[model samples]
Target: MDKKPNHRLAAHMKEAGASNKGLARRVCEVAARHGEQRGTTHVSVQRWLDGGGIQPQTAAFVAEALSDKLHRTITPTDLGFPGPVPVTPTAGVNYAKSLPEALSVLDGLARLRPEDDPPSELLLTEADVDHAALTWLVSRPDGLSNDSAGSRRVGMRDIAAIRTAAGYFMQLDFQFGGGHAHKAFRHYFREEVLPLLDASYSAKVGTALFGAATEISQLLAWTAYDSGNHTLADRYMMSTLRLTQVVDDRMMGARILANMSHQANYLRQASRAMRLARAAIEGGRAHSTPRGMALFAAHEARALSTVGDHTGAGRAMNEAERFFELADTGDDPEWLSYMDEAELVGEFCHCFRDLGKSREAVHFAERAVSLTDPKYARTLGFCRMVLAQSQLLNGELEAAVTTAGLAVEAGDALQSARFQRYVTDFQHAVSVHASNSTVQQFNEQVRDAMTQMDDE
Candidate 1:
């Protein structure tokens, strides 16, 4: 009888309280128990989960190993197929009576859509996995695969792959909204890609892996930030900072600081934001590409603007613009290359909005919105939200309400908690005109959005 697919591998590993690496180790140990020396690397196991179907011989070996360790008379039949081969003798009782359930869990995880809300059912905590650490930690179990047929060098092919994937995610994020993209993308990073990197990278490969991990972590942070999960966002930001430093990419280090500054700004710690942003700029001065310098300055200006240092902010903005103008069109560093005219304009819009220069904010925001890709729907949505408030401050209540609705609509598909914060800010701004019919209706819409988002 052909049984269900053997999707329980991940779930079984989880119930066994084994990391992917750990499961590989135990599988090897079991192979050893059977007097067969098998080179079971975590990479091999990961590949298995990545739809690399197991071979029949290896399948029986794994099943037997799992059965013996699980203290049961395990057979291939347990894995959902009627075996032509005889059942192997076991030393003890079934160690994993829950294997079938574990398999079900793994099967479910394999099918989960990243865009949908994470299942409330798993009940796993941060303690269950430090997704940030997976890339660096999960690689080769001591006695695993060693088919290093070529020179042990970090190749351009590998770097290109990482860069390509990162670019794809970043573009998707910009046009569709980070909230729309982060959940699914981050899940792949955490569950699939990271583990593969963990098992295969050499030292140079390790550095590149960390770099990619840091970038992806920052993406997750931004998504969390957009959705209003401040604490989670901060955690991801810190983790990214740690990873960037591990890669020793100074430009990326500076960019990570800028990200931290944004979190600080959102938390209303203007002084901290200023300090972080300044550190980012100063840090970049030592090692940044021209574009990195521009990016750093842009972040610093936003921080300075937040604290009413208009003179300093203006100077920083000018410096940023000058550097941006000098940005080379050649091969660029990973982090700094992502900063372009639209991003710089967006930062300026943020500065003006924070500084209470509503008209200037609106002007820069409109420019940013026009230049930003549709993939950046969330960023544009947030920009529109800021623009609406700026218009309201300029005594354009109807425009503010209309734009606020657009912001809400733009963010409708995102899973981020940050939309609530944006809505809350909009509500606070409109409180002065609560009696006005337009403002009242906008408030009602915002409240409903808040309710729906919160339920998720």
Candidate 2:
């Protein structure tokens, strides 16, 4: 089967579920693994898929990347190319519209999924919500709409406000832990905010408001999930997906699937997780961004690893690597900017840990941990918890306990009940060694710490 560079890479990336930036991130990550310098810029990738050929020498790296990420070997032939390499699709989808219309699309996108048919009405009518505070929420970004408002351009500042607030709430939940703050925020979104927008927003203003609201709502759902409120998390997910439908952002819509995959993994439903992850991959194909593909590949590896399909998972990892290798450093989308080599390695670390490759797990975990910012406390805590588990399995009880302690401490300061639960799971593993005096002591310390944390 012969295919063009774009077609083969594009098809494989669709199966892997990566965004352009995500693909670049993964490539950067794989290159770093081999001690080489690589950049998958959003712009350059877009240029390549737009018909400009990428660097020929970088093709093999793309295959190796997907192989490492997906845990399976893929030939250039698989990507429909000859010789040693294949080009990764770097094309991106950008939605350009007025702020108000963009917002509506973003909100609509949050609610819709590729698997679902289009809904008739993406947003709730004013009759469906209250409008008392809607006017206030829909005010222009800059305090001045009276004079030159006609010529004022809407910029990232508006999006930044939403992102900043979303981040703040996320942090608040993480630090003190998810409880009233999470619930209160959800309530505000559902009652005070949603209703207000429903009742009072104009066409454009309403769309923008809904878009921002949907992003915030998703974060709320994440917080709730972290706090172990799965039912509420599900509700939020539903709402979030609905909002995306109104907002009309396909990439964000795909993200909803990614989050669902995470939820499935938490419940130990590996098959379900893999399905959702694959859906995300397939859905993002229209956009053909590297980041989306990379993300999909990582999730596939995660699901495969969870199901104990080490070989399959490894193959998926390789597929992820291939796409990453072909990533260039230009023409990217903002939604996918957070992805990079560090995050890719972090995903691999999880896969290795689940596959019982303790040494590789520890190595990747350390590398992943070192690459991230301290502000990502919850992620770091997760890495530490996994590392602790690996240590315990290796019979390094003391080291395990100490590492677990650090995870616990990090979790305490962050707002993730989920991370705390992982810590508990590690402790449970420790309890199996009750006959060992050191293990017993370690268990006791864990119990005491948890009890104290709960009480406080």
Candidate 3:
């Protein structure tokens, strides 16, 4: 580090209403969010003020934190860093190579729009996901920093507020589906969480803070998936995977891989889905509870079923059930709170339906519907739809139509693109029996529901 007095940085700090400590805190936070834990502190800030040089990447974070504070872009040259400014890409589509770079991509993603040509022009590819997963496995977490900075102390209260709101955001996703569920978390994460990152705290609190951020990112992925914006969801999930390296959260990381598998299955990339599911199972095995293991196994089963691997799918499903049977709710993570017997049964319903086991599909679908809580509005709607599909595929036209009507009415209160897709799929399946009066009535009901959902 060059030990020269940095008048440029000092001048900007004055303009940005930042004290040395405040700037240090922001740098620490910005680095962490991007994927590293840079140990910036008031002392470090004072040293920079004393003309000490920093790494180009660290300089970028300082510039960014100041830019955030001053509400304008600040370059490293402006801060006395004698290096060329990093040319940040227009979006976070590709995996970031460094924390400072990750910060740049995240900033761009937060403000991204259709007008952002480079990123908006780039569609998601399998290479993007494959690279992210491989990077996560190979990445090592940055060493924890005990040093602290910022204007105020950050503690558990701040973390709780973010986590609590995240919990609420998740419930909203479950009840109403993901159409708009991610918005609140986005606002809260940007407004509440980011500011704290700029504040001072122990590394322990920072880890907790980073964990909350990871959760928000993962939730955004799911909500994006729910909205049928699979591309955007992939980007967020890939980002989440990067962050897991920072937090050293193997269990959560594995869960996210399984979610990626779920999305892959939806997109009909069963090959990729199967790979992701196996990766999740392998990675999470050490740290995960039986419930966690069960969840991963269930996802594997679904992917297997999608690829026409009946025996493999059945074997995987059996493992899922076996692990589930050994699960103790007391040992489950908060994220796994939604994965009960009903949820597992729903997975079974889908797999059986895909595997041409209509009898088993209907059986589990009924079990899932019966076991599902009414407040789990979206799950109930999905289970009912699967049940209807199973009935239709089994040549029970009237029963299928009746079940479909129930599904439409049951899901009416929710807005989910996935459910809408399910409705469309069922409609197509029942088209052959269009002459039936019950099928006609169900089609009209579906049209009305679709219209209402679309209008909303």
Candidate 2, position 362, lDDT? 80
Per lDDT, the best of the predicted structures is 3
Clash numbers, per candidate: 21, 96, 6
- Predictions: Cα RMSD each: 12.3, 23.0, 5.9
Model 3 agreement with the true structure over 1-456: per-residue lDDT tens digits: 124578898999999889977988999999988876676778778867876535555778999999999999999988887653233342456776655445444443444322222443344566776777777666687543444335457898888887888889899998998875766656665556555654667888888877877787788778878877666676667767777776678889899999999988988889889988988998889879999999999999999999889999999999999999999943776778899999999999999999989999999999999999988888998999999999877878788889879989978757678888888999888888789888889889988887887787
Q: Candidate 3: which stretches are off by over 4 Å?
A: 1-77, 80-90, 112-123
Mark the regions of model 1 whose C-alpha exceeds 4 Å error after superposition: 1-159, 175-180, 196-206, 334-338, 447-456
The CA lDDT of each predicted structure is: 0.62, 0.59, 0.79
Better candidate by lDDT, 2 or 3: 3
- Among these predictions, the greatest TM-score belongs to 3
- Displacement of residue 120 (Cα, Å) in model 2 is 31
| Quality of model 1 by C-alpha lDDT | 0.62
Worst 10 residues of 3 by lDDT: 112-121
How well does candidate 3 score on lDDT at residue 412? 71
